[model samples]
Target chain A: MTWSEYGRLFLRHGWLMVAGAAVCGALALGLTTVQEPVFRARARISMIPGVMDWRMRDLTKELARNAVATFPSDELLAAVQDQIGLQTDAEGLRAGWDDGELIITIEAFAGDAATAGILARTAAREFHSRRSLQFTEQDFIEFIEFEIRNREPELQQIAPNVMTNVLAGLFVGFAAGLALVLMLHWRDEEWLLTRQAIEKSVPQPVLGRLRSN
Target chain B: MNTNPSSRQQDAQEQVAHELRALRASIELACHKPARSVVLLSPDNSVPTADAVWNLGLAFRTDTSSTLLADSDMEDPGLHLLADLDLAPGLRQWLEQKGQPASALAATHDHGLLVLAAGCSNEDPLQWLNTESIGWFAPALMACAERVIWRTPPLDQSPVGVLLAGSADAVLMAVRPGHTRRSRVNRAQRILAQAGIMATGTVLVES
Candidate 1:
C-alpha cells in the first residue's frame, strides 16, 4: 500500500494503539498488586569438633554426612512447624547440605516476613537436634551463620518489578494494535489513487475530471 | 478558499463550463469542417461526462442550430440522468433494429443542444460496433448535426470505445484528478496511437 493510504489507516485506527497501551499498562499494575510479595530467610549449621568427639572428629564428620542425607525429612518439617506455630502444612521450609562435607543450610520463603524468619531458624534447630542424637557428643552448632548481613531483613519482599512489567505490557500491547491496523488496511483492496496511475494503465487523453460523489 | 457548499458548487459549474468551451473550440479547430463528430472517451468511466457533454453542447448551441450529444455507451448509459431526460428511444435501436428514431431526440435545458441516448439494445454492443454498418451509421448521424459529441465508454475498459474512437473524427479523453491514474492515461494514449485513433488531447477535471 502507498504511504498516504497507510497514513489514512493510521488516522483511522491510531486510537486503538493508545487505548491498548493504556489498558495493558493498567492491567500489569493491577496484576502486580493482586499477587503477594515473597520474603526468604536462611540459616546455616556446621558440624564442628567437640570434647568427646574431638579425636574421632573425622569419623564423626562421616557420621554427620550420613545424617545430612535425611536433613529435610517430613518428620523434621513437622517438628519445625510445631515449633514455629505454623497452622498450615509445610509450605515455607527447604533444607540441604552442600556436598555433605560439614555445613547444612535451611531456607524459608513465605508471603510474610516473620513466618519466613521463624521457619528458617526452626529448621536449623530441628536438624541440629536430630544430628546430636545421632552421635554421643553435641558437635552440631545451633546456627554457625545467618544469611543476613548489613541490616538486611530476614524476609525481604522480592516480587512485582514495577518498571519491567509496565514496559513489557506497553511493547506487547503496541505490537498487537499495529498488527490490527495493518490487517484492516490490507483487507481494503482499493489500489488506484490518482490521475497519473489511471493514465499509465490505459492510454487516453483525459478530457475532464470531476469530484467523486 | 470558500468552504460554503453552494458557492463551491457554483464555482465548479462555472469551471466546468469554461473547460467545455475550451474543449469545443479545440474540436472545432481540429475538425476544420462542419458536421464533424468528436468521441469523448475517459480511461476511467466514473468521470463526469454527462455534465461535460451538456456544457459542451451548450458551448456550441448559440453558434449552430443543430448539435448532438450522443450517448454511445450502451453498457451503462447514465447521460440522460444528468441531462434531466427520462429513459427514451434513440440511436442504439436505430442501428440494431434498423428502425428510424420514431420519436424526437431528448432535448436538454440548453437551446439547440439535443441528446441521442444510447437507447435499448439486447445484442452485444461490441459485435454491433465491429460490423461494417458502423461506417455508414456514423456519417448518417453527422449528416443531420453540425457538430456531434459522443460520450463513449472508456478506451481501455471496452473494445466498443476503441471502435467508436476509430469511427469518430477525433477522440477526447475525460479524466478525474484523484480517480484517474497517470499510467492508465499513458496506456490509453498508447493504445489509441497503436490503433490509429486520432487522440486530440486531454480534459482534466478537478472532480
Candidate 2:
C-alpha cells in the first residue's frame, strides 16, 4: 500500500493500532529497564613516525616503511600496565588497530561511575608511559589530533547504516499495519455497496485502489 | 391561500397525498396477480416526524378486509409512538414466552391495520431475529394477512428488512429525494433478485 493509504487505515483503526503499539512498546521498554547496565571505556594511543638515519640511501622511503610497520608492542604494553597499576596483566587489555591509530577499549561492570572512570584513565596513562615516548602535553595533544584525522574516512563510511535501519523499520511497520486492516475487513464480508458486491462476484482479482486525494 | 412559504408547504403536502394515493392504486393493481402474500414497505420511518408512518398507512387504503398494514421493522417502530400504544404484550414478549409461530394478532386503532411492533425492551433485535422462531412463525403470519404492508428497517444496513420482506411478491424500492443513491438502489435490486424477487416499482419519497 502507498504511505498515504496506510496512514488512512491507521486513522480509521487509530484506537486499536495505538493500543497494540503502546502495549508492545511498553513491554519492550520494561524488559530493557529490568536488565543490568554495562559500561564501556575506551583509551586511544597515537603512533608517531620515527627519525631515520641519513646513512641509509633510501632514508625517506625507509621512514615511510617504518611508520606503516609500527604497532603497539607487548613490551611497551607491560610497562604501561605497571605504571597504570591495573590488577590484571597487559595481555588482559582489549586493543585494536584502526588505520594508523591504536585504540585500547576496556569494558567493565562497575557498581558506580567513579570507579569506571578511574580505571579508564589509569589504563590510558599506563599505556602512554610504557611506550617509552618522551611526550610533553603539547606533543601528546598533537599526536592525538593526527590520529583523529587519519581515522576520519573509516568513521564516515559506517554513518549511513544507522539511517538505513531507521527507514527500513518504519516501512515494515506501515506495511504490517495496512495488511492487518485489509485482513480484518475481508474477514467480516461487509459488502456495503454494489461496487463491493460486484467486485466480490468477479473471478479476477479486485485491486483496492484508493480514491485520489 | 396567501402567496408565501406556508402556501408552498400546503401545495407540497397535497402533492405528497396525490402520490400516496397513486402508490396505493399501484399496490392494489399488483395484488391482482394472486400471489400468496405481498409486503409493501413505506418510506415513512425515514421521515423526521413520528406520524409519518401512520399518515402513509392511512393514505394507502385498500377496501379489502384481509389487507394488512404491518409494523414489522424492529429497529425503529414509529407506529407505537404515533398510536400511543403500550410497549408490553407485543411481538418480542410473545417471542420470548411462546417461542415463535407467535401469530396472535393485535389489531390497532386503524380497523384493517394490525401492528407487530419491536416490543418493549432495550436490546438489539438481531438476537431474536437470528433465531429459529421467526422462521417457524412467518408462514402463519403470511396466512393471516392477504396483502401485508410491512414498515421495515433501513434496507442497506439491517437484516430485519431483508429477512421479513426481501422475498415478497413486490419489494417496493423506497428512495428519499437526495439520500438514496443509484449505487444503493442497484444493491437493493441485487439483494431482492438473489432471492428470485423484484420490486413492483420504485417509490420516489419526498418528506
Candidate 3:
C-alpha cells in the first residue's frame, strides 16, 4: 500500500487507538492510586585491614566474602529484627558484596522511608558487631576493622512508578487497537470501496465516477 | 463559503449532471457504431441505476437526435417516476397488446427526451419478458427515437435484467463503492458471460 492509503486507513480507524490509549491510561492511573508504594534504603559497610600486610589483606577479603554469603541468613535477619523492632520477616532484607571496594551492601524495603532507612542501618550495625565479637579472642582482631561508609541510610521510593506504568499501558493498548483494526479491514474483503479494489476484480474499464446524491 | 443547504444541494446536482454528461461521452466513444439501444445494469439496487439512466437520457438529447428512456425493470421500475409519468400504458402494455410503440411513449419536459414507463400488468413480468414479443420490442422502440436507453433491474437479483441486457446494442454496468460487493459483480458478469454478452464499460457511482 502507498503512504496515502496508509494515511487513509489510519484516518478511518484512528479513533480506536485513541480510545484504547485513553482507557488503558485511565486504568493505569487508577491502579497507581490503589497500589501500595514501596520505599528502599541501603547501607554500605567497608572491611579494612588494620595492619599493612599481604596476609591481613587476604584475610580481610575472605572475611568480606563470608559476610556477603551469610548476610541474608535467618540468624542475622532475626538479630536485625530484634534491634529495629521490624514487623516483617526476612523478605524485606537483602545483601551483596562489591569486591572492588571490599564493601558489604545491606538493602531493606518497607512501606515508608523512615522504616526502610532504620532497617538498613540496623542490619549493617548488627553484622559489624557480630563479626567484631567473632574475632575478639583471635589474632585477626588486630588485623581487620569494620567501618560504616555512610552514617545515614540512602533512601529512595522505587515502586509504583506512575509515569513509566502509564506510558507502557498506553503503548500496549495502542498496539492492540491497531491489530484489531487491521483484522477487521482484512475480514471485510468483499467490499470494493476504492477504485483500485474494483479495478483489480473486474476486466472491463471504468468509464467514470459519479458523486452520491 | 456558501453554507446554504439549497445551494449545496443544487451544486451537488450540477456536479452529478456534469459527470453524467462525461459518462455519456465515454459510452459514445466506447461503442464503435452508433449504438441505437443501450442497456444499463447494476449488481444491486444500492446503485443509482435509475437516476443514471434518467440523467444519461437527458444528456443524450440533442437538436438532431431524440432519446427514448424506457423502464424495463418491471419488478422495481423507477425511470417512470423520475420522468414524472404514470406507470401504465408502457412497455408492459405494448408487450401484452401489440400496439404501436409510439402510443406507449410519453413526452417529457425536454423536447428531445421521451419516456416509456414500466406499464401495469396483472400477470408476472417474467412471463411477459420471456415471450417472443420482447425480442422485437427494442427494434420497435428504436423506430420511435434515434436513441433508446433501457433501465433494467439488478443483474444479480433478476434473470430478466440479464436477458434484457443481451438484446441491447451496448451494455453499461453501474456500481457503487462500499455498497456493491465484488462477489455480486462477479456473479452478474458470469450470468452475462453465459449469454455471450460483456459490459462495454462500467460507471463508478459514488452513491
Candidate 4:
C-alpha cells in the first residue's frame, strides 16, 4: 500500500494503538506500585600500604583485588550475616574495586533501608577484622592498613523504576498494536475498494464505473 | 441558477446518463449476437442494483428501442417502489395465471421503457422459477420488447438469481466498491460456473 493508504488505515484505527499504549503504561505503573521495592546500601574501605616502597604498593593492590573477589564469598557472607543477625542468605551482596583508588566497595540489597545499611556496615567491618587478623599472623601487619571511608552507608531504593518501566511498556504496546492492525488488514480479503484491486481479484473484465450517489 | 440544488441534480442526472450509456455500449459490444435479454445480478444486497437496472433501462430507451425492465426478485422486490407502481398484478400474476404479458407491464414516463414489477405472491416464488414457467414467461416478455433487463436479487442471498441468469442471453454482475466483498463475488461467480453459466462482465456501481 501507498503511504496515503497507510495514513488512512492509521487514521481509522489509531485509537487501538493509543488504547494499547495507555493500558500497558497503566499496567506497568500498577505493577510497579505493587512490586517489592529493593533498597541498596554501599560502603567503601580503602586499602593502604604503610611503606612507600613500590613492592609494598604492588602487594597492597593485589590484596585489594583479592578482597574484592572474596567479598561475595559464601564464607565471608556467612560471617557478615552472623555478625548482623540477618536471616536472609548472601545472594544480594556484591563487591567491586574502584579503579586506581585502592578501594573495595561493598554493596548490599535488602527489602528495608535499615537492613541494607546494617548489611553493608557489618560486611565491611567483618572484612576489615579478618584481613587485620590475617596480616598479623603473616607478619605483614606493619606494612598494610584498612580504613573504613564512609561514616554511614549510602542508602537508596534501587528496584521498581516506575518511569523507565512505564516508557518501555508504552513502546512495546505500540509495536504490538501496529502488528495487530497490519495482521487484521492482511486477513480481510473482502475490502476491494479500488478498480485495480477488483481487477486483480477477479477474472472478468470491469466494463464501466459509476460514481457514488 | 447555476449553484442551485436543482441545477446540481440535473448535472448529476446527466452524469449518470452518460455512465449508463457507456455501460450499455460495453454490454452491446461484448455480446457477439444481439442479447435480447440481459440478467443483472449482484453478489451483495447493499449495492444499488435496482437503480442500475432502472437507469440502464432508461439508457436502453434513448436508442428508440423498446426496453422492458423486469424485477424477478420476488423475495425483496424494489423495482415497483422505484417506478412508483403497485406491487401486485405484475410478473407473479402473469406467471401464475398465464395472463396477457401486456397487462403485467407498467408503462413509465419514457414511451419506450416499460417495467414489470415483482408482483405480490403468497406462495414461494422459487416454485415459479422452473423451466416450464420461465420458458413461457421469457417469450411473453420478449414478444413485447426488443430488449428485456431482468434485475434479480443478490446471488449470495438467493439461488433464484443464478437460475434466472442461466436463462438470460447475457449476465452482468453488479458490484459496489467497498461495500461488495471479493469473497461474495467469487462465490457468486462460482455458483454461476457450477450451473455452466459464465458472467459476460462486471459493472462497478460506485454507490
Candidate 5:
C-alpha cells in the first residue's frame, strides 16, 4: 500500500490500533511493577601477573592465608570461599570464574542491602589474600599495583544488568504488539482490497489513452 | 400577439424540445436493458426529466413487459407536473390506510403511463414514507404496473433516503449539469447506500 492508502486505512480503524497499543503497554508496565525486586551485589577481582612482598603484605591476607591454602588447589572460587569463612559460616559464599576478562566475580543475592554489600566486600578481601600467597613477596606487591590498575578500568566497565534486562522486555513487548496488529489487519476483510487489486479488478472507462510500443 | 411573438416563443420551445430529445436518446443508450424494476432517484423537484424519460423508453423497448413510472416523491411529486396528470392520492394514502384499495389510489396518464403522486400534502407526510409502508406499497404498485419506474425524492432531502422499497434490478442517479456538485452527488450516493439502493449506473442531466 502507498502511504496515502495506509493513512486512509488508519483513519478508518485507528481506534483498533490504539486499543492494541494500549493493551500492550499496560501489560508491560503491570508485569514489571508486580514482579519481585531482585538486587544483585557484584564485586570483580582480576588476576595480576606477580606476587606480594613479605613485609608489605597486609594483615587481612596474613591472617587468612592458613584457611586459604587448606584447599591444596589454585582454584580462585574455592580459595575465596575458604578465606571468607564461607566454608564454616551459616550462609555459603557464591563466587565464579569470569571467562572473558580472566576475573573472578563474587556475588550474593539477599533480602537486605547491607548484608549483600558486606558479603561482596568480604569475598573480595578473601580472594585478594588467597591470590597473594600464590606468588613471591616482590611479585605480590607488583601484582597488587597491577590489580589496582586493572581493576580501576574494569570496575568502570562493569555495569548492572538492569538496563539490558529492561530493554529485552521492551523488545518482547514491541514484537508481540507488532504481531497482534498484523494479525488483526489480516482478519479485517476491508483491508484486503489493495490498491493494486482495485485498479486491476474493477472495469475502468477509458476515455483516451496513449500507447507506447 | 402577432405571429412573430408566437414564433419567438415557438423557437424557444423548439430549442427546449430539441435538447430534451437529445437527452432522451442518451438515456436510452445508457439503459438499453433493465431488470424488472428500474428505479430512478433524484434529490429534489428538478427531475432528470428528459434523461429519465429517455432511459425509460429504452428500458420499455428492451424489457419483456411494459415499464411503469411510479413517482413516490412525497415532498413534491414532480412526475405530476412532468407527465401532466391530476394531483390525486398516491403512495401516502395507500400507506396511511395500510390496506386501502390499490385501484382507487392510481391514475393512468394520457400516455398510458401510470402515475402515483405523494397525494395531497399532509401535516407530517414523511411518517407514511417509512420502510414498513414502503415495503407494502412497492409490490402493490408493481402489481398494478408491469415494470416500475420510481420518481423518488432526492436522497439528500428525503428521510427515507432512497426511492425504491425493495430490490431494484437496475437503479440510476441523475445529476443536473452545473447545478449538482461532486459533493452533493456523493452525499446523494451515500444516502442511497444507507437505504441499500445500489445504482447500476448514473445519468448526467444536461441543463
Candidate 6:
C-alpha cells in the first residue's frame, strides 16, 4: 500500500491501538498498587581452616571454595526449611560468594521481615550441621567447633518499581496493538475510497470521478 | 410561457440552456458521424437524464432536425411527466401490446420534439430492452429521426441500462459532484466495460 492508503488505515485504527495501550498501562499500575512490598535478608557464612600453614594455603582455599559452592545443596537446605516459615526449596533460594572464596552470603526475599530473617539464619545453620557430619570421631579433634556464625543480618524491603513496570507495559502494549492493527488492515482488501484509490486498486484508468456528498 | 419563473428557476433554465448548447457541440465533435440513439444516464442517478434528452432533442428540433427521445425506464418513467406528454401508447405499449411506432411517439408540445415514454407496464425491463421489438426500433428510429436520445435506469440498479446502451450508437454519463461516490463511478465503468460499451463522454453536473 502507498503512504496515502497506509495513512487512511492508520487513521481508522490508531485509536484502537491507543486504547489497548491505556488498558495495559492501567493493568500495570493496578498490579503495582496491589502488590505488597517484599523484604530481603542476607546471612554471611565464613569457613575457617583447622590449621594455618604456608604449605597448606592452596588446600585451605580449595576447601573453603567447595564448601561455599555446596552449602546451598537441597539435602542440607531441606533440614531446616520447615522451620523457616517460608516455602522455599534449594532451587528457589539464592546464595553467592563474592566477598571471598571462604565466605558465602545466603539471601532470602519474603513478603515479611520475619520470614526473610528466619530463612537466611536457618540456611546458615543447616550448612554447619551437615559439614560436621562429614568428620569421623578421630578427625573431630582436627575440625573442632565446626559451627557457623551469623553476621548482622541485612534486611530491606524491595517491591513495586512503578515507573519501570508502567513504562514497560506501555511499550509492550503499544507494539502489540500496532502489530494487530497493521495485520488487520493488510487483510482487508476492499478499502478503496477515492478516485486515485479506484485507479490503484483496479487495472482500468479512472476516466472520470464524482465526489461524494 | 412560464412568465412567473422565480430567480432560482430562471437561473436553472439559463444553466440548462447553456449546458445543452455545450453538450450539443460536444455530441457533434465527439464523433464524425453523430450517434443516432444515445443513452443518457448518471452514475449516482442524480442527473435528470430525461431532461437532458428532452433539452437536447429540443436543441436539434430547433435546427430543423426531428429527434426522438425514448424513456426505457419501466420502474419510474419520468420523460412523460417531465415534458407533460401522454403516457399511454408508449414504448411499453409498442413492445408488449404491439402498438404502432407512430402511436408510441408522444408529442412533447415543445418545439415539435417527439417522446417515447415507458408507459404503464409491469413487463420485465431487461426482457423488454432485449426483445426483437427494440431490435427493430433502433434502426427504424435512426431512419425516422435526425437524432435519437434514450434514458434507462441507473446502470448499477438495472441490467437494462447496459443493455439499453447496446441499442444506442453512443453513451453519455452525467455525473453530479458531491452526490456520486468514486466507487459508484468505477462500478458503472465496470458494468459498461462488461457490456462491451465504452462511455462516449462524461457531463459533470454541479448542484
Quote the lDDT for B119 in model 6. 80
TM-score of chain A of 6: 0.63
lDDT value, candidate 5, whole model: 0.51
Which docking class does model 1 fall in?
acceptable
How far is each candidate from the true structure, as Cα RMSD in Å?
A: 8.9, 14.2, 7.4, 8.2, 16.6, 9.2
- In candidate 6, which residue pairs get closer than 3 Å at backbone N, Cα or C atoms, i.e. clash? none
Model 5 chain B: lowest-lDDT 10 consecutive positions: B54-63
**For model 3, how does the per-residue alpha-carbon lDDT over B1-207 read when each residue is reduced to its tens digit?**
779999998997787778777877888788877778888888878788878787677767778888999887887778778778899888898888887989999998854589999896334467677647567776788899999988887876677777777777779888887888889888888888898888888878775
Tell me how each candidate scores on DockQ against the true complex: 0.25, 0.02, 0.43, 0.39, 0.02, 0.08
DockQ (0 to 1) for model 3: 0.43
Name the DockQ score for candidate 2. Answer: 0.02
Sorting all predicted structures by DockQ, with the top scorer first, yields 3, 4, 1, 6, 2, 5
Task: Give a tens-digit lDDT track for model 5, residues A78-193.
Answer: 65456544442323345555434545565655444555555566556655665565544535444443231122211121223445545555666566655665565444422212
Q: Compose the digit string of candidate 2's lDDT tens values, residues A53-84.
A: 33332432333234324423466445545654
Best by DockQ: 3
Q: Count the backbone clashes (under 3 Å) in each candidate.
A: 44, 1, 0, 0, 11, 0
Lowest lDDT block of 10, candidate 1 chain A: A143-152
True contacts kept of 3: 0.77
lDDT of each: 0.65, 0.48, 0.81, 0.81, 0.51, 0.68
Residues A1-213, candidate 1, lDDT per residue (tens digit)?
Answer: 578866877898898887878888888888888878887887766555444354556654555566656656888877877786775345566655554445566677887888777777777776766665644354444322212221222556666677878888887788888887766544332223444444444444444433322
Q: What's the lDDT of the predicted structure labeled candidate 6?
A: 0.68
Give one digit per residue, the lDDT tens place, for model 5 in B46-85: 4464345434533353234555666565665555665555
Better candidate by TM-score, 2 or 5: 2
Error of 3 at A209 (Å): 3.7
Task: List candidate 3 stretches off by more than 4 Å.
Answer: A1-36, A39-110, A113-158, A162-167, A173-177, A180-191, A210-213, B1-17, B121-124, B131-134
- lDDT (10s digit) by residue, model 2, range B1-207: 558998898997786667667656665465456444444443333322224345445554457655454555556665566555665555666667664423435566554566566575455566666546556556656666665556666656555656666456655555443344445556666766676565565454444
Clashing pairs in 3: none
